[model samples]
Target: MEQTLRETIRNNPKKILGVNPNDAKVSLSYLTVAFVSLLIGGILGMLQGLERAGLIQLPSWLNYYQVLTAHGLLLLVVFTATFTIGYQYANLSHSFGGLLSKVRKLAWIGFALMLIGVVMVTVMIVLNEASVLYTFYPPLAAHPIFYIGLVFVVLGIWACCFGVFINYRYWRKNHPGQTTPILAFFAMGVFILWFFASIGVTIEVFTLIPWSMGLVETTNVMVGRTLFWWFGHTLVNIWYLVATSAWYVIVPKIIGGRHFSEKLIRLVIILLVILNIPGGFHHQIVDPGISQSVKFLHVFMSLSIAVPSLMTAFAMFFVLERTGRKLGGKGLLGWLKKLPWGDVRFLAPMIAMISFIPGGAGGIVNTSNQLNQVIHNTMWVVGHFHITVGVSVVLTFFGICYWLIPYLSKRQLTPKMNKIGVIQTYVWTVGMALMAGSMHIVGLLGDPRRTSDTTYGGHEIAVSWIPYEMVFAIGATLLLIGVIIQVYAVFNMMFFAPKGHTEFPVAEPEDDATPAPLWTERWGLWIVLLIAVISMAYVVPIVDMILNAPPGSPPIRTW
Candidate 1:
């Protein structure tokens, strides 16, 4: 009787109309927070660039590290976190027809908690009580309220994660024989990763709270750092997974092509989730306390992530070529000319994919023990993430905004708006290239990062870095322009654009594609495997750090 009712409700004509307006409010609210963060973060980023170029001096009330901390926190944490929640919830709503009312309430509750957290953290930063950079690595402590703010944020994320799980369970029970929509599957992967990846950081933050309150005298820096990166590097892959979802499901639709094998895509998601957390160990390669042999092992574990990445690259290229050929291109390379280069939907993510080539290569260098020694502490490291996250992940997010905002708002993507987006994409690409390229080169020339001034009394080598620093300022200026355009475009589309329908743009698989095995849906088995992998990678080193611990350091404020 319940099954029959579920089927009837699912097939109702009104259910297929569009996203539930109530659900759209949840997503749009999160997106609003996201773009607002982007605007502020972008401004902070430009200030850092100008300061690094020695073009402007900040007032006494604000220091370089404060700006750095705020910039990283806003864009990296708040912006990305809010955007992912907003976007993924929309995916869940679309895939399941509509979210459960309870789930919608959870979304709003999560939003409120996160907003509270962001407010607290921002206040601490403003008061200069927390300039602890985004990583918030320990011994360098912030006010206890900063850690408390982070707790609220994590709690908020947990709320959303539970909501997704509930929705997934409900859908599976209703449609026993069917695979969940590909986007929902991706959403499951995203929130699952989110829930688990945050565990280490939650533990870290709980420890920090007491020490920051002077309840504990000292905290172990090694343990704190280990815990942080366990979450930190996984956060990187979480964004990658989010971007990959679009590449696999949405981009193909935009390009008029079928998605690659469903089985392969699911396999990729599983592999990424299991292999991801261990890869964070590589970020700690330069730090001591971990044995050299373990670090060497972690190098391989980190590189293991590249296998699925390569598979994705291959699959995407295959889809693009096949689609272009179908659109009537004669020669081997001529298919490239047949793509929709003018479409912002395709153009932004295509460039994002292209940027990952260099980004991925740089990652390989960062992972290698010998190679990492040279650049680990340099601006090259910053440049690497700038291209990886800044372009690859962020540009994809920018592309998503064009269709998603309009769809949620029941508005059209006007030609004029599309042109603005296209120009914004180019401007951002050029800006990131100039800034990241110069950072990489100057890093190789031995320019250090996190230091406000490297002039060294105008030494010859330092003097040489001035030109590259100037380029950084110029790139930052253009990026600010891009940010202004993007934020303006988002609000305009959400509010003022003409009323019309927009498609969600999920691609279908090829006709002859093999059915994805039901075994892939065994999320329990996958989670077990993920835990096992994490244990193998972390247990030994963490045990060593705890057992052979030094008397830890007390809180110290550098600023």
Candidate 2:
């Protein structure tokens, strides 16, 4: 069996690299990109925080538009994308059977493409030719290279998806009639969503890049916005879905229990894919071009997406509670007392969940048309997203890395440093919360977002909000320190961890008297495809309205 397996793996190099890909090389490469992106993004964030505090004079070269563009692109595209694909490669290798070589090579190709795209985009921005936000929204243009770079990035991501699909096929083939591994399925689901989501962005990149460079007469702003959100909304979901998988896997391990319900987990994955795509329309709520009915429908779908999110939270908490019980914890609050609080793995997830509460609440508020009007383009909006998306989800990613690095390297972390990192993660979470709260309050006071500094109606606003800005800067400093500690931990695990061969724990055999039907074979994906088509149909007319608004009529602005 071993020889057969080795031969099979050698025959298919892509699968081996994909299943048990070498982390020492690829993971570190991706991490290097993430580190640089985070540093740049963090600096920009600090600068924005200082500007909000009114502590420093703004510089001409530190243009708000350019900083904002770079910050968004680096964090959203570079940091999140690189970390996720890297994690997926690592997780899929361990979770799915053993390593397959062919899949790993495909992953390498994907990584190369990602690096190429990043370099291309970075050069354009440095040259002052592509200051357009990562959105690359139409009417506002950039060098054609920016769009080309993005295409290369997407192509690389698509190649990564292919690697994921091949492994899924192998798993199914080997483990006939077994329910797909939950984490593996979720990873594949993200890719499926991404594949469809990229269609719109692909269209924009191909059509608009040449047009923006004056190779064509013009491009439609309305069409571009519509397409971008199709990619944008799902893009966020791509990251969140991966974060959710981490939560599902790591939370159980932290609490010392198995998942609550595999079926429910599957349901959550399906629902996310279903609800996320249609809900992209909500981003257009402020635009006049979309019809009220269609907008309302999107709002409804967006609300529906929250259902799975809540369900996931429940699933996690319920499992944790059970684990606590099994470990001999006594009462309602006893589980809290019994948990291994000193374990960074345990503390990290706990902190992540806590941060999620305010973030999720803020998201619901921000997505509401009436509430969004009050905070739109304000510091509060920035705070809200950073907390929900940045702190909650990304922190969870950090937690997973902390937990997995030691295991993968066959070593234990510097416990003292790990503990410090956990504490810092908590501090950062609270700091983000405080920052978001202050921003929300100031937003209610009518402070705009993405501005280096602003004066309303030629009168400078009172500096009463200075305290919040100060608090935010302090938080940023602490957050940076915490991230640095984490990097230190990862490095130590890679270099100093015990050097020895270790075998993965074997899954116990289950007694199965009867064979099961294939879920994939039984359910045709046509229904899902139909839903996607309908979603696009719903969005097309909204674009028309935005593009053909009557002259002299102000663009529709919703609350």
Best by lDDT: 1
Give the per-residue lDDT of model 2 (tens digit) for 454-520: 6444464645555666776676666666566666666666567565443322122113322223463
Ten contiguous residues with the weakest lDDT in model 1: 7-16
| Candidate 2 ranges with C-alpha deviation above 4 Å | 1-24, 57-59, 457-465, 496-559
lDDT tens readout by residue for model 1, 408-467: 999999999999999999999999999999999998888998888889997999999999
RMSD of each: 2.1, 4.7
**Overall local distance difference test of candidate 2:** 0.69
Model 1 residue 415 lDDT? Answer: 95
Candidate 2: 10-residue stretch with minimal lDDT: 550-559
- Candidate 1: list runs displaced more than 4 Å: 1-9, 12-15
Instruction: State each model's CA lDDT, in order.
Output: 0.93, 0.69
- In model 1, the Cα lDDT at residue 217 comes to 97
